[model samples]
Target: MTDEDRYELLGEIGRGAGGVIYRARDRDLGRDVAFKLLRREGSTLDARVRFVAEAQIPAQLEHPNIIPIHDVGRTRDGSLFYVMKLVQGQTLKEHLNGRTSRSELLFAMLQVARGIAFAHHRGVIHRDLKPSNVMIGLFGEVLILDWGLARPTRGLSTARDEHGGTMTLDGDVLGSLGYMAPEQARGEVHRQGPPTDVHAFGGVLYELLTGRPPRHSRTLGELIPRLNELPEPAPGPLGALASRCLAPEPGARPQSGEELLALLERVT
Candidate 1:
């Protein structure tokens, strides 16, 4: 059978600026999978380059906590698509809707840190690290999702689009505001590194403890100055770690996810 007939699209499970994810059945494997298809309308060459990177990057990261890409191809109409394991669970953002135990939340966050640590070790930096980008599976599995904004620390920083134009320029602002690091907020892409993701992990931890993001501003202008102005977290080891992770200066925070994971392991 042709690539078009190999998977039958069932329904859309998620949609983003670059692509749409559908619940599809792999005819050959007879299993349900997530089929992420690059959107056609308004899909610029840069967006297409990023979409391909999003799939290719994670496909190389073979970790239990990172979603696995089974196959990637284009439809008969020429829209790019990739198949991945269909997770049966809510996003960490949705899971946080109910009052979760502090221990349970920390455990989940620890798992996220582990996954991120592995990615960092592999030289991949997940520029966007937020609760919504995390998945909590039905059996207590935590998987990191969305590698579109991820950059490599050890390789060429920029990607080439179809027209040979640079896909991601240094000054292009990316990532969510509330969880974004100071350098990231300033669009200083050159300064983003493991510490960037560490800063976001701290934001995630702060939200878990307080049910709110570290920053409350509605605009980048209002948020940039106040990025360092986080209220006191609850008193304890975890709280102390959160404060350190959210430190305004990158040097003040954990250098990498591995360091953050080590620190978190000490919290009782």
Candidate 2:
């Protein structure tokens, strides 16, 4: 059988800044799958390390909402590739392109919070938790994808706080600009724990309600002050919870992802 015929490569599914994803099928297993192929230009040592780390992260996690990594290996040309369950759906970012109802928003965020809580309990922090990273399937499944920037800080840390996890080595900002925590924007080398993930969740909730980012500013210098001193949106339970979750100080935010989920349930 031809390589393509041996294992069917159906078509391209998605593309990201780091790699391209494809829909495939396992000929032996008789099941559909997805493959993530890293860009050739970014297949350097650091990139390969990051890719392997991501592949292993999900293997360590056994949660319904978190996407599980199925396999990983290097291509003959030295390119890196990984496989995962093929989830057929658009991202939360895509779902929010137009008007979104409150119940719909709450339903989506609930799945995200549950998944993140599972990761947090396992001592894994998803440094990148944005709408684009959340996939909502047609079969009523929400899968949290991408862990290239996850930080595992259970009992390991250093003065610089590099806990040997799949972290960004270049000190490049981890989270997306609008969803990043205040301390993260400062380039602080602190060990990202559960609280960091909570902050990003809050940002997601804010955008879900208002159809805009929680902290909006042109530059980092401008964003810090806005995040610190910005007034609460309005008189609503979800709005109040959003403010608390997006608190400038991580200490002022929810202690864990589970706590945030509880609060969302109460507010919703």
Candidate 3:
């Protein structure tokens, strides 16, 4: 059936370079769905391609932590769009507006890490890992969102990603500046992989501890100098863990989600 025939557009809930997310309803199934419509005008070919990956990548991985995809198709206007389960809680960004107890923070982070690990097991590398893209459901389900920049690891490929010559992620700084790893910010796609994601996850952990992004210094000029400042010998265990993850060299950081989860569990 056609997109319009199946889902009714209720209203816009969010917007990003990938496209607009509408709070839609599946007429036949009688349930709410988040619909992302790829913009036709003002969208470059790469953006459209990433929009396809954003719709498809996450749909391939079936984990409780990864947002699930329900349907995908083109609209009557020939615009690409996809439907996914509607989350009912705030983003990790919104949820982190203020600090919570240490235990609560660690629990949420562990779940987030588990989700990342699950994706990694499926050969998916979430190049963009940040609080804004992570949704914490009302029932405490932590979901990783936005797979537009995600890439396949060695010996892995998805049906949607292989649809055309569109599998290669951009060599530009295709991730959120503040949360990106140094290599990612440098547009060195060749050096990007699991370590890149771990470093960014460390940045997230740092944010959780300090309530500020560790990579706040954006540009290389500012970031390089600030990295020299070091973390000032970490005030506590959590701080130390974050410090390890935020190390300038990706190799020095936790290499895998499992390793991170184990280390963070010890500190927690």
Q: Candidate 1: misplaced stretches above 4 Å?
A: 155-165
Each prediction's RMSD to truth: 2.1, 3.6, 2.3
Q: Clashes in each model (backbone N, CA, C under 3 Å)? A: 0, 0, 0
* lDDT (tens digit, per residue) of candidate 3 on 108-166: 88888888888777777898899998988888888899988888775455544466655
State the C-alpha lDDT per candidate: 0.84, 0.77, 0.79
Number of clashes in model 3?
Answer: 0
Over 117-188, each residue of candidate 2 has an lDDT whose tens digit, in order, gives 888888888888999999889877899999877766663232224334444545336568788887777766
lDDT by residue for model 1 (212-267), tens:
88887778888877866866775677889999999888999999989999999999
Quick one: best TM-score, which candidate? Answer: 1
What is the overall TM-score of model 3 with all chains considered together? 0.91
Clashes of 2: 0
What pairs collide in candidate 3? none
Compute the lDDT of residue 85 as modeled in candidate 2.
88
